[model samples]
Target chain A: MSEKTDIGRELDGALQKPKRQLAMVFDLNKCLGCHTCSISCKRQWTRDEGMDNMWWAVVNTQPGKGTPKNWEDMGGGWDEKGEPRPSKIPTRDEFGDAWKFNKEEVFHGGKGKVTYLKPVNTKGESPDWGPNWDEDEGGGEYPNSHFFYLPRICNHCTHPACLEACPRGAIYKRDQDGIVLINDKQCKGFRFCMEACPYKRIYYNHVQDVTQKCIFCFPRVEKGVAPSCARQCPGRLRFVGYLDDEDGPIHKLVHQWKVALPLHEEYGTQPNVYYVPPMSPPAVDSLGKVDPSKPRIPTAYLESLFGPRVKEVLAVLEAEKEKKAKGEASELMDTLIVYKWPEDIFPDFVQDPAEL
Target chain B: MLVKRIDVNGDVLGDPAASVWSTANGETVPLMPTPAAMQPTKYISTKWQNEVYGQTKSVSVKALRNADEIAFRLEWQDPTKNEQRIENTDFPDAVAMQFPLSEDASLFMGGEGTPVNLWYWRADHPARARSDVAHGIGTSRVMDDVSISAQAVHANGRWSVVMRRALSVTKEAASAIQIVPGQTVRTTFAVWEGGNLERAGIKAFSPAWLELEIEA
Candidate 1:
């Protein structure tokens, strides 16, 4: 199909170039696969009936099926020619509906022995799948098994497929910070955005009849406080800053050092969030000898996600690690280490939420 | 089709199976799926291209109007009553009627400079109907004023809906069809079966416009 169309052009025309774009970078090497970010995000935003299953910030084990199960196979966003790709709205069952435990029957109904604690879905049936159903079930056999935590959130793309797919024009990218948001009042609960977002981050709010997603913690950002997911992360792997700020870690990692790469660049949405490819331990032979030449996690697999730049990025990262290990100064290593908490990372958004 | 005029105190014709509706001839309009090729290109177009949707094939429609208001009774076969939007994927059954603002307006939702007024009713919002205006496909906007009222009932494998509206609405903030006591207007109908996840442009629509004349 032909790439360009008047409709696509018209949608692009409506967007104003933001003065500064807030961006995030997650170092996979440092992630502990903990659900702290997910929990913090849930406590801050998604704590309602329809939002029960929503995990705005999720850490899916790579090489395993991610949340919503095989989301990578679901087509969405723009194709190679910049044409919109078709995608389905993932059902609550596919997303793993929030399970309801039989607390009443187990605790108060005098059937504790028989009922115990059983989880049932909204339809009163045992749930078959959930958000983290494939947790830790990474690829390969036991000897060569490998996995990495892939922390995910809305990329808040420069050319958001969700924004373009909205026929009501309800989704908008803020001109100041390039934060994409769906106007709740204008939204008609159409859910076209959910289908168009390749990352499958947008969620449907059945109660309110509108689509909801990560707001990038705009309320906290406005008060100069880091987002809850980033602020409460125990691994301290997430870095946030304006993409244009030359002094910020985001720019240094994404543009200057070029160590961090956007996931699935082929999706063509221009996702703002980047990832520092994980460097894994060497593969083991049948004799239990470590093969230094073969990384446990295949480079071809990482290339499929982060594009051809994975090899170059990994090489630079390894060189930087070598320098740091030999007691030599490596600005890249120091930035990734993030020794000074919020100050060294989110310099522009340094104010604590409590103080604010 | 002729819309017979009823007196203000005449027997209520809200029920589709009411004896009064027997007097008005029912039109069996053949319905066809809104072509997937014509759906908006952004999302739904590709997802539903090959999927068989809008399985409903036809509907029986009867019309009645009083001196002050107009009413329509639409009946179609539906196995289930999908009244709840409680699930993220659940869609409520719905129906709509379309009228052109001008005589020469395009039948396909009207084009620019030719707008169409639409009265949309959904099973979830059973208490009232919403008023919307469309310049063309994908150009519909819900009007602020909701002057249309509707009630729907599903029983015995069918949905019976009764929708009523005033003859003329104040044009200050809303645009509506000015229903004269004795005037013929062109109209069309569309129905959505929520069980099939039908919404937006994924619907069954009347093949062609039907002419309606109000009794003087």
Candidate 2:
């Protein structure tokens, strides 16, 4: 499918331009798949009863079914003709219902010896799936098998399908930082946003009867503090800043170096989250011979996830790495290294959360 | 359809199973599923299109009015009772009655210039009902008034709902359809089966407007 459309362009035109568009760039090569970002996000937001299952920032093993289980196969977002593709609402089971262990029976009950502790869901049934059920289960044979951590959150698209799909006009894109939010009072809990979102990031709060998603930590952003997921990341792989800020690492990595590419650009939402494709070591043959030309993680598979620009981005990264190894001043490599902490990564939002 | 008039001080006729309703011949209105093509494009593209509901082909409706109030008793077969919205995927069983503000208002929720008054009742909220105004599809807004009293009971695979309101409201609402003695009005009905996960436009609706004449 074509990447751009006149309808999408017109939709962008109708919206009031934000003073600055906030963006994020994630270097996949640096990701450790530790899920510190996910845990930090959970502690900050999603601690309620219905929100227990919500993982606003999820790190999934590539080439495997994502958080919602086979979410890539579920259609949403705009098609080639800029029309909404038919989709289905991901069930609680599909999203992996929060499991409840029999703590009382195991610890306090007198018949502890006969009955063992087991995890049961809210519906009183054993859960079959979970957020990281397929964690580290990559694709291909033993010697050629490979995987990379794909951390996902709300893209906060320039042309968000969730915003357009809301009939109540409850979803709005802020004119200041271009953050998309749903107005709780106006939201009728229809869940159209959940279906229209190609990323399947939006979640339903059964207690409140409304749909919820990653808010981009607007409360922190307003106070010049970065989101918990970005701030708490130990890898220092996530860079946050306004796209127009030429001096910021986001612009350097995304536009200047051209190493970061948006995931599934074919989804046609103009996603703001970009990824620096992962490079892998050469694959080994059954005869114990290493094939230098054949990378363990196929480039074609990466291209399918990040679009056709994967090859060029990888080539640029390789060239820059070579320059840096030769003791040359490579600006791209220096930025990726993140010499300073918050100051070098999120220049605009550098205020410490504790200080705020 | 004729709305039988009762003396205001004599006896209340709010019960759905009351013998007074039996005296009037109940109309068996055939209900058809609201076409998927007619639903909002977003809804048509979602899992709702695959929803299998509105299987009930018909419903029995009877109406009665006293000097102070008017009431409608709708009875339909529903094998399940889905009254809770506590679960993420749970949808409540619901029903709505529609009346036009003008004589020539469109039967399909009225047009832009012509609005419709809607009394919506859900099984989850059994005590009271919502008063809403709709200009057209996707333009429904709940008004800030608790003007209608609703009570529903499910038994033996059947649902009996009674929705009642005063003949004249003290407060004025833009979409309120005036109900007076010796007046003829057009009305429509919609039912949602929560077990089938039906909500919004995915429902069974009366194909044509039913003309009701209030007895003087």
Candidate 3:
């Protein structure tokens, strides 16, 4: 990792530039919709009271209403001139609730024959949405229906709208690693951060009366281990390392190969987390004839998310896949394949968490 | 407004409904929205543009002091009793009393080297008021030792709250405002209507400080 690099510059001069920036790149093509990252993040950080409904690392199905329901339409982040765009705070019902189950009635209430287990929210109403309420429910007509898993965490943006929105100066990016954090001691729970975050990643802790989000597992990162979400990912789709580490996959995939792109770059926060856009099979016509020109997963939708570079990135990926198919050497293909376990993905953070 | 000196104990002064409160003259303090230009961040300033916040027109206040304690009865009309911070959009109704540490402290929360001490109470935390010291906008810090005690009752489409504290708190004395007998102090007030989603610098506040003369 290179030192003295001015990474994650402030929204204005309100914050000092960081020496280094830790980032993650998710290979969206490899994600299995298994939610290992979400479960790992929950078990590690968000099991407390008032955090029952918060899923810091959520695997959202593309082309579906996200965790907060229509978060895309909610305005936030900076506009073209770096002016803050207005947005409302997402409510509990919008993000869905921590549903309670009738496990007791089904198993031990002696009504097992008739009583069935069902989930109900704190208000005792059936939840209309959840973090994965639209799981596997892809969009499009019969044969062409398609979707991909989009696992999201706090983007840890360089120009963090959340950090800029905090009136109390409670949210800041670390000068060392560029990890954005909320100073719970200083936070008055104004929640302007939630309003300003285009990604809608921050959560309000009602019990503690403060705002909380993904910390990037700083404690584990400082101990030379990757974040729990990355380390525990069963699909090994998450790559973690310093952005300036040219040998690292994060730098190669994002800066060198230029395949990984930030989601919703128009939000203008410069998110640290990037995604290698997913590839899909060709669409089928009404007569069941394969249409090579049209991808099942619409390119327009991906462009709306990762911006117009989706076409270029997809072309490069397809070319590399063809090279590998013909038994030719392809550096990009090898990096994406993860042939060497942790070393291939996160070379700098290969420490086994079990040993720690 | 004079804070009348009474022979009653702290308990009598701490109750908002006490008959002794009737003896003290009530002052109707007019309030206005905190200037959007003075808001701390661009996001807050932008969000406040279309929102109807700080709509509360005025508040009624009565001040009294016993031998060792000072108390104030504040009454404001708010039809909704928003006490819970359970939902993301739920902001509890709150009120604050501000006093300057130095005469130079600006009414806009104070400036550098001129801090203001704030006695803040929220509907959710009704039993105690947080003692905060701030230096300019968005700088309010909750003191290590909370010195103010609060009692509040919501009824008849209005809220009656009593905030009580020692005349002089020796602990964290630097941040705590000292209320001495026979002296006048400059103080201001702010109120937040949770239903309006008003918080931080988006609330109604007294444009100028009110001078309170304490009876010797």
Candidate 4:
């Protein structure tokens, strides 16, 4: 098997194969950058004393530095030979410290007119970056400036770098559904997971002195309910199901339709979470004429993130979209459209959370 | 090194500046970097491959014992004081004394079935030390019920710390080393420089065990 596709094969018996892997597919085209997923995840798990800076579910604008501020430049995950890649532990400032606002002086102190609210960081300085520091700031010149929202969560990879990085065996992939988690009781606050995760999704909880990330809403998943992020997303772009379930949308999109691709597959972690590449309109010329040569969003930049297969996936998406526009039958377009709520996107986890 | 029998009060024995420590013979234990080959994970070894860490060359040790307890004063030089654990990247400076449960146990940590007791002191928690037991590297488990008293002061680019405990402990006896007077035992030392981001197997340690004799 190619080293790029294999998972846990090079771990030397350290990782165990899960019976079934739970996966999610995010359609970047439909994302509206509303941030409901981020808020839902925060309200569900990370609203604690030390989790002020953690965004377990983040929606970053493309061509931007991302949450940790140029995290792509930081090294992590595995090398081409399947050797572990070393990474730096991102600092509070790099991840953008939770801003402290002067609510007291503005609202309750009876000085609202004079003292307007301002955000101060931990060191009592103005914050330079945040989770969405460069929102809507896409690359390229005027008539063609374009960007898309890339909503991210823990990949819950097949061979998790965080699990292998931990010396105390504190991180594990669940045997039942392959949901990666940190066993806080066994964690010694070493933060090695933060250093090994290529995605840089893990956050350190200073109060608890432990590393934390997206748990994939395992409790809700176990009870036949989709993850909070997917359930709360207004775009209905997130698909959650068992990867091996042939009839499921996740399998169809990932294995059959092959439209969904793993982000940064070269990281060598074999992330279960996949994404359908976003399509952009063609760029316009300086003469105000429609230019069909290239898209406003550079294909090279998209290829850098989604890998070489992005062009092929985008071609398939374009063809299927054209067929749908011509009023012809297209399973791919029908699946992407999601005619029925909850049932079409997540058949296995279609149970409403409110009913539970 | 002899743990001298002193007539000092328990309060004074735990103080790093206490004059009672002057009576005991102090030894400068030489330290070396923990071998990179022994790092528990590949990521850690790779992270340290091009970096300089575990640079602390030596530490001063002095032991003193009273009627009921024993105390050891450790003094080491460090340019920076890192005592905060509030940030993800902040690792507090720490020191640990290791004692083997079996004579044949390894100095690096004990082997399987051969446990080692560790008296661990971190700069963040200044008032107390932790009692931990481990069968091998990366297996250290805290003995929460057992408390080891510690007092530390960082001044003039050097840290003076005193760690003390009962001469004999009954609770968690299997994990805790009972330092009996008039008996010879072996001990080793490891120091973590938080400024260098050293922790776990990435610290400086005495290569060999130092023999200790407590005066009866």
What is the descending lDDT order?
3, 4, 1, 2
What is the C-alpha lDDT profile of model 2 across A1-356, one tens digit per residue? 22232112455446345566788999999999999999999999999867988999999999889979999988888899878886767877888888899889888987699998899876889989989999999898987989999999999887788888876778988888878899888787777788889999999888888889999999999999999999999999999988778899988887788899898989988888999999888899988799988888999999999999988888888888999999998999899999999899999889998876
lDDT of 4 by residue, B118-150 (tens): 999999998899998989978888887677999
The segments of candidate 4 whose C-alpha lies over 4 angstroms from its true place after superposition are A1-8, A13-16
Candidate 3 vs candidate 4, DockQ winner: 3
Model 2 clash pairs? none
Best by DockQ: 3
If ranked by DockQ, best first, what sequence of candidates would result? 3, 4, 1, 2
lDDT of 1 by residue, B8-31 (tens): 422365555566777776798888
> B133, model 1: CA deviation in Å?
3.1
A32-71: candidate 1 lDDT, tens digit per residue = 9889999999999999867988998999988877877788
lDDT of each: 0.85, 0.84, 0.91, 0.90
TM-score of each: 0.91, 0.90, 0.97, 0.97
- Candidate 1 vs 3: which has more DockQ: 3
State the C-alpha RMSD over the true interface residues for candidate 3, after superposing those residues.
0.7
Measured by C-alpha RMSD in angstroms, how accurate is candidate 1?
A: 3.6
* Model 2 misplaced stretches (Cα beyond 4 Å): A1-8, A12-19, B7-14, B35-37, B42-56, B77-89, B102-106, B110-114, B155-157, B175-178, B181-185
